[model samples]
Target: MPDAIWQKSSYSAANNECVEVRADAEAVELRESDAPGLVLKADPSVFADLLRTIKAGELDHHA
Candidate 1:
């Protein structure tokens, strides 16, 4: 995804240390703003499920 047009969230940090996302015909991709070399790619539906889970706080750390 070297040539991918990554989009940063409008709610992200002003300093630019946040997640970026992009999508194409084959997959949706994610990468950290400060670590663009690494990316995570997933099927669009899977990404949607991930977003839902996140919004539901299923992945939140508990202490």
Candidate 2:
């Protein structure tokens, strides 16, 4: 996983608190900037679906 470069979301604020993503052919990995050691893994397709859903306002009820 160290081989993949992690990137923060463009929407993230100036503060260090943000989510990060590291992806490759096999899977997409996610972690929080404050706790780099803990990670969450998801298939690329699943990740894409999640992003689409979020953008479509399907999950905004939580906020």
Candidate models: Cα lDDT each:
0.89, 0.93
- Clash number for candidate 2: 0
Model number with the top TM-score: 2
- How many clashes (backbone atoms < 3 Å, residues ≥3 apart in a chain or on different chains) does model 1 have? 0
In the order shown, what is each candidate's alpha-carbon RMSD?
Answer: 2.0, 1.1
By lDDT, the best candidate is: 2
Steric clash pairs (candidate 2): none
TM-score quality measure for candidate 1: 0.80
lDDT of 2 by residue, 1-63 (tens): 678999998877798889999999889999999999999999999999999999999999999
Clashing residue pairs for model 1: none
Q: Taking the tens digit of each residue's C-alpha lDDT, what string does model 1 give over 1-63? A: 457788998889989999999998789999899998888999999999999989999888852
Q: Which residue ranges in model 2 land beyond 4 Å of their true spot?
A: none
**Cα TM-score per model:** 0.80, 0.88
The segments of candidate 1 whose C-alpha lies over 4 angstroms from its true place after superposition are 1-4, 61-63
Lowest lDDT 10-residue stretch of candidate 1: 1-10
